[model samples]
Target: MRRIPLFVLGVAAVAAAAVLIAPGDDEYPANVVLPSATGLIPGSKVLVNGFDAGQVDEVSIKDGRAQVTMRLTNDFAPLHAGASARIVWKAVLGERQLDVRDGPETNPVIPAGGTLDGKASDPVEMDKVLAALDPATRTHLSSLVQGLDHTVVGNETDLRQTLRQAGPAMEALGGVLRAVGSDGPAIRELVGQLNSMVTTLVNRDQQVRAIVSGLSGATEAVVQQRDQLRAALAKLPGTLGTADRMLADVPGTVDKAVPLLEDLRPATDRLPAVARTLRPVLADLRPTVAQLRPTLGALGTLLQFTPGLLDSAHGALPGTESAVTSLTPALSFLRPYTPEVVGWLSNWGSSAANYDSNGHYMRVNIPAGISSFDNNPGVMPPGMVSDPFPAPGAIAGQPWTDAFGSGVR
Candidate 1:
């Protein structure tokens, strides 16, 4: 008032305007994550309940996430949990804004500088929509719609009746659709498997045809032998009954035979090696067997004669025993004189050996004994000169004299 400087007053007015325009500390900064930050920047409006609530103070990328810092007014303080924020636009190319649909008031308030997790909604681009539909598809769609419209108009009554009848069918179809939808992956796999099987069958068509041809031939053969087959079939029941009885006893048979089988196991295991070893032996034995053939025939002949020989020997055996028994007494009587008789015979044989074909006879000579030859000739020598010698009593002269008496009278 007292001559104030005009420049200073001007600077003071600018300072008051800055202070009035700047945001106060009462505002809360909420961090929101968006899928994308396209067409968004700082100073973008944040709306709550279709009203402007705050502005985005910062927009940045941290750790690959698009982060938007929204500074909300004090009236909208403390966003609760489950509150969501979306980036929306008026039109495809319009300016983007944040729209927060918060949770109930009963939820706990979010403090200042808190975070609110959110998603970004993408606006439909007219150019992309236009690109998706080509001229031909658009033409077909128009024709299809026209046809459907005309059909619906003409079949109103029939359509109503069809819809009435199809109500339960539709309900059932809904359930089937739900089942298919729930197991869509499994159903798709099943369809793929069926398709593969069909393709394999198609590839093996020639084999399938051959199998069919074989089946037809078998059928014809069966038909030709139908009567025989029928008779066999008629007898089959009795055969089957017998077999069934045998089968029923098989358990007991097997139980009894188990020990035998176990015992035979070792032998059976050794059989293959034994058979291999026997092969060479049997080959070598073939020639021996051939040579034995004639020997076998001779043996058979000898065997026939053997019985007769044995019978004759058997009959003679008793007499032979009796003969041996009868010689026992005579043998015993001569047993004592055997040595003396043997000695005497040996000495006499030695003495008689002097007589030989050379006219040499053994002479008995005792130097001191009387000589039988005398030089005087007697009228009759008391010895017979005939072929027969006289007896000792009949002889007249003493032909021989003993020490006690004359020899002959």
Candidate 2:
């Protein structure tokens, strides 16, 4: 009242106006404290019941941690004491909110002084997360998007390739679809054809059965002859062996028969010549026998005389006993001089044969064949000429038929 300053008078008026216009304390705004949550700046909205309860009003350091104070309108004050609150999405745009769920009917209410049990939410901040993204991460995301766009763009090409790879199958499917498209005619015709074929087969069934029955009968017949077949098969080996032996003999038989077969033609051609030569010889024999027949009649009387000659022919051979006895005495006497006699006889023959006609002594050289000669003259062929000149009277000493007969004997 006594001369107060103008600034002090205005501050007092503003304080009185704030107290009078403010909502009443008993009608209280909600207290939403970030008692456990730290790093929350002032003016951050506090959520309750999935809606904005209030904003962070003040922040201060209490004990070792930051304590945040918040104010809620009286509208959400009840939610603070009676319900649970959690962060929730407001919209797809850059906004967020909290959602509250009331407890079950029997659940006790949350005390105002107690903690809300909130934790730090892992939220994607549109503004902050976008701002924090570096060039590389943004580039990677861009590339991913571009790749997706490219994949979408190439979908037609990929689809065409797949279709091409599946061409035959797709064509089959198309044919099946076309077949299905025909209402009934195609199917009916196919069915009719099938029916006809089945009918034809059915009609021929009896013939087929008959053929099978005939084969069965043949098989039964073969089975009935099993023992006979076995016996025949067992004998086959012996038969084959005989055949092989015959085959083996064929070559030897052919060798012997071949020369006879070759001579057959020539022999046939000479048959008349052979007969003529034989005929003359036989005719001569017959005539000679006829001429001898008269002589033979006379020879009949001579035949009686011929008996004496025939009887003398019996004595023609020397008596074995007397001749053997004579030979012993003669051979004994001749044995000592046998070698000297032989030598003298050989020299005499040589001397007589070697002399020429004039009696002038002629020398004869031994022939080349003398090497094959031996002292044993018994081994030599009778009358084999060993001298260059004939021995004197050598041929005259023997009868014409006696090659070694000596006239002296």
The models' CA-based lDDT, in order, is 0.79, 0.62
TM-score of each: 0.28, 0.22
lDDT of 1 by residue, 1-409 (tens): 6457887889899877544433368677788887787778899999875556899999999789899998888787667777889888745665788888787889877656667888886766666775799999888978998999988997899999999999999889877875786678899999999999999999999999999999999999999999999999999999999999999999999999999999999999999999999999999999999999999999999999999999999999999999989999877555544555676687667666686678556545456422245753534445534334433322334332332254322
lDDT of 1 at 350: 69
Angstrom error at residue 226, model 1: 1.9
Q: List model 2 lDDT by residue over 1-409, tens digit each.
A: 5557877899999877555333455222333333344335566666653344576666666664444555556665433334544444444453544344445546554433334433335555566775789989989978999998888785988878888999999779866764574446778899999999999988999988999999999999999999999999999999999999999999999999999989897988898999999998998899888898899799789777987897786786568667878799677545544555676788768776755667746455666653465775545465555544333334445222222244122
Task: Indicate which candidate wins on TM-score.
Answer: 1
- The best candidate by lDDT is 1
Error of 1 at 381 (Å): 32
Off by over 4 Å in 1: 1-162, 238-288, 292-409
How many residue pairs clash per model? 0, 4
**Could you give me the TM-score of model 2 versus the true structure?**
0.22
Which pairs in model 1 have colliding backbones? none
> What root-mean-square deviation over C-alphas does model 1 reach?
22.1
